[model samples]
Target: MEQMTATGVSPKEVRQRADDAGMSILRLDPLNTWSRVWLPDNMDDAYIATVDTRQDRVFALCAELGCRSISLNATFPRGSMSIEAIIEDYAKICAASAFDLDCSLEFIPLWGGRPLAMAWQIVQGAGASNGGLVFDTRHFVRGKSDLADLRTIPGDKIHCVQLNDGPLVLPDGVTTKDDRYDRKFPGDRQFPNVEIVRILSETGGLNQVGAEVFSPMLKDMSAKHVDFARLSGRGAQDSHGNVRKDLFFTRTGSHRPLRFGDGTIHPCLWS
Candidate 1:
């Protein structure tokens, strides 16, 4: 929180900065809760209460932080709750804000091989026109979806996308989606980032292209933070890296995955 306040930053400040910097959207991350996997089944009741409280805190914090949208990393046990129930609860939580915050689902095929194509259909069927899937390049790959499948979605149906690369393995073998998700930035070795970027380009402006490749390796790099200015030109360097780091470093390791975002998606694609 101190980091947020020290720079005279607040949610409102973030909006102003984004506007001044020529950005239309701010990307907000929700904390992931995959740790539940390790907890003993006997502790379910206690953790449920605890998790619920934390979940409330998270929603309140996002609103308080002035975040207009959030990427949810929730993966529930299939029978634990139904998607309808989850969406209803999620809507109620996000609606806590007087502002309409887009509620996007982080589809993890970790639990089972649920189709990305099918999930989007369900979201659309559920009348969640305001919501969409958080499309991670690797996740989509693992989901084994072709770019053509994306055309079926109303361009706006894809809420956001996370860009990254990985081995050309099919999604069937991957046990949990989180393992693939918690990877380093786009051009890092061990992933198909370039092709994924192409897909995102075809789709056009999403809520954000979170270059959220984990930075554990670069935790100690003096260049931990990137210099967006050095790469600026007609670009003027937006908040996210337009550096367009081709898969050059993809064979090498990057400290962090690059991140990108903009508020609107190209509507004409659907038309």
Candidate 2:
């Protein structure tokens, strides 16, 4: 679950809520506050102190909630920092949290991390055992990530796989920011989600798979009204018309086998 989902609520309360609902939080999405401010230009003594404090709070919350991983992204604009500097900062962050949990860096085409390979480079450069990558299919498709580079990453380096689909080619006048909020379900076939999933599975990186749809259409609907079962059902269908019953939406602690079009079954933990 996204940590922002429990904004203004205490970590204890958040854990209690999840316990009541029979769900476990596998990880938190995008440790937002600290990442946004952790830039090359802002690394002064005061800023470092502030960042440390924030990290303490976030780590404490994760420990309280029993979440073992947290996703992070570098959304800073291009030229704000060099790739080397970004790698250094990410390494420090990962090393700092290595004792507690995993810190996965997500690559965004519009931001510093792009094309999947560079994200892997940062993770590899970090050299922290707990440092990993968050493989989001939408960004992979939209950014035109190289398949060859995707194959090079080992299974353990990939911490999470966020599954969603979008058009292979963006429509006219639609900026990436505009397209980001409007994404299709996993089995839409508009994006090559299957091929990417297949590659990740072959490399043994399909540990955690979750449907992360950010659509304007879903904004007005309440959580209970959203049909997760339908989402899981569509996600279970493959290009060859094969459907797998094991690929249902489930919370943490409940394991499920996700079967892709290639007829390979991988143990998956849904977030």
Candidate no. 1 TM-score? 0.60
Candidate 2 contains a number of clashing pairs equal to 0
lDDT of 2 by residue, 1-271 (tens): 2334446677777899889977677786556343444443323566434334366666776888888988786666656767778788888788778436899988887666787988888888889889899988888887789878988999878888777767889889997767878865565546666666777767877656666777775567565445443344345544422234344232222212234444343322132
Give the root-mean-square deviation of each candidate in angstroms: 8.2, 7.8
TM-score for predicted model 2 compared with the true structure = 0.75
* lDDT per residue as tens, model 1, 6-88: 67776567667767866554445553442233222333475454343244555555666566666665555444656566556
Screening candidate 2 with a backbone cut-off below 3 angstroms (N, C-alpha, C), the clashing residue pairs are: none
Listed in order, each prediction's TM-score against the native is: 0.60, 0.75
The local distance difference test score of each candidate is 0.50, 0.67
Candidate 1, superposed: residue stretches over 4 Å from native: 1-25, 31-56, 79-97, 112-114, 170-182, 228-271
Clashes of 1: 16
Highest TM-score among the candidates is held by which one? 2
What's model 1's lDDT at 210?
A: 46
